[model samples]
Target: MEQLKQALTSAPVLILPDPERNYVIEADASDQAVGAVLMQDQGNGLQPIAYLSKKLHGAELNYPIHDKEALAIIIAFKTWRCYLEGRKTTVYTDHCSLKYLKTQPSLSRWQVRWIDFLETHFHYDIVYKPGHKNKADALSRPAHVAAIQIEGMNPLLKGLFTHGYTIDPEIPLAEKRHLLQWDNDIAYRKGSMKIWVPNYPPLRQLLLEEYHDVLYAGHFGSNKTLTGIAKHYFWPHLAKDVQKFVTSCDTCQRMKSSKQKKAGLLQPLPVPEQPWQVVSLDFITGLPPTTSGHDAILVVIDKFSKMGHFIPTHTTAHTEETAQLFVR
Candidate 1:
């Protein structure tokens, strides 16, 4: 083991990637470090082109195992961008979740940003391999260590217990039991805190108030509100419930309106068959008050003849009175 460790740490020769040839990347991450190897397909076997490994620090140190694994891929791609950007590259990772990285739900802010970066910057396919088969796994850890020691329990549990949640039925039985505990009549997921939610209205309202009315929430729109609440809570049809709640918010209705759509195309009223047969009427309000109390103009238009009639009237004129003047 000591000899192997010495050999792995020893400097070695690296091949230059051929632009016209295909490339492959093997990436892996340990609790403290991320490592990857860039390889070119030589007709006989895979030739190592480059090796990368870095210790995790700061916010990156807090990332969950899957994210660390993903970080390894991102780092590898960035380091070898010159060779992999234009050509087809296949990325191999021991973490299976990375295969569906872009489609995973309830992504953290960093995860979303990482996914965006990966999508925009790389043209590649991710392939999943067993930990034992991944070549880069050794580079990320000491050769003496036969297995990677996970840093902590519930690394992915932050914000997961902030709200009430139920174990999804789709979860496998073993995982369901592992993630949830039944106490009294309510079920809870164990993490830094217990996550249990009563299906009652009060709890739902409290969650809505915190997520939709809080200062940090900023009265975000329904989709954003749903995402914010979902980071820590789960319920059946939770998004639909959030949609309904946000849609019914009086504050949102009074202070905000959607600008995503424009008014539909103008439909001009059908041309009238004859002058005065079809008319359009409107009142020009807020004119200067005249001494005779005539401070508004009622304009009537004959749609067929393209002609108009203007009459002066009081701004407070009643509908009945206005109709009588038009009759006269």
Candidate 2:
């Protein structure tokens, strides 16, 4: 009676018929090698159940480095689904990323489907193992490379094993040309072409009276020309006219190039701790003589903030006069 009570009170562990009945699966990157060990417990003792390993279907991508962690999760799930058959299982992988599976905010469509399938079909736990300890899974990596070569040689087998479908068709030349021309707006000129001057009063007045002055007032680049036209003529007469014309300007698009200048490194001020304590002095030499007979400007800048002070002075000014200018 005491023995029965002791057995009843003790924690229970459900044991399988043969030691080989327990499912252990491993997935690795090398060759998509999936390994399984099934254990069963006999009344006599735990017995060697069944051990199986196989190269998975599919060629390895040439750049498998980025997708290694994703592939590991997929192969691990596939092996469990294929062989475990209603049995609880443990899957081991080396990818740490899978540890946050439940909390990941975004996943690719393929990953979403994989997760859904895993949640629906299996009750299992994913365990992380270091790469060196996961030897059976490591063996699968080489198979991926060989599979790729084999698929490349055989088109029929390739089609049969490929993950997605493809279609190819031909279109008539005339139809292709029409499709190519559908959205094209660019103008082309080969020889001399007649320029049409608009008969509208405002546009004519703008071209005849204002265009030359605006072009000559500053640089005649297309952007500046367009801006001048917009400010003086287009903005006053038409609603949203500047936006429409600017959007279609091919000259601006072709002429503009992006320029990035490196920033100057910050140097500590000579009088490091005090503000406005240090200054730089220089002269603007060879300046045209001013009406006051000054030929150059003395420039001084605060080293800390680079704020400038310019003072007009003559080249012939004596040191005493320069000192007076500085004092003033």
Q: Report the C-alpha displacement of residue 142, candidate 2, in angstroms.
A: 5.1
**Residue-wise C-alpha lDDT for candidate 2, range 268-316, written one tens digit per residue:** 6455355567777777879998888889898888777778999999877
- Cα lDDT of model 1 by residue, 1-328, tens digit: 8986565545353566789988999999876688998888767578788889899899886676678888898889878887787788899987666888888778988788877887887778998875557789887854423311222313333223232234333334424568655544335444311234445566667677777886656787787676545433455578888899988988998999776777889897677787799888899999998898889999998888879899999888998989987887
lDDT for every model?
A: 0.71, 0.47
Best by lDDT: 1
Q: What residue runs in model 1 are displaced by over 4 Å at the alpha carbon? A: 1-13, 142-328
Task: Give the number of the best model, judged by TM-score.
Answer: 1
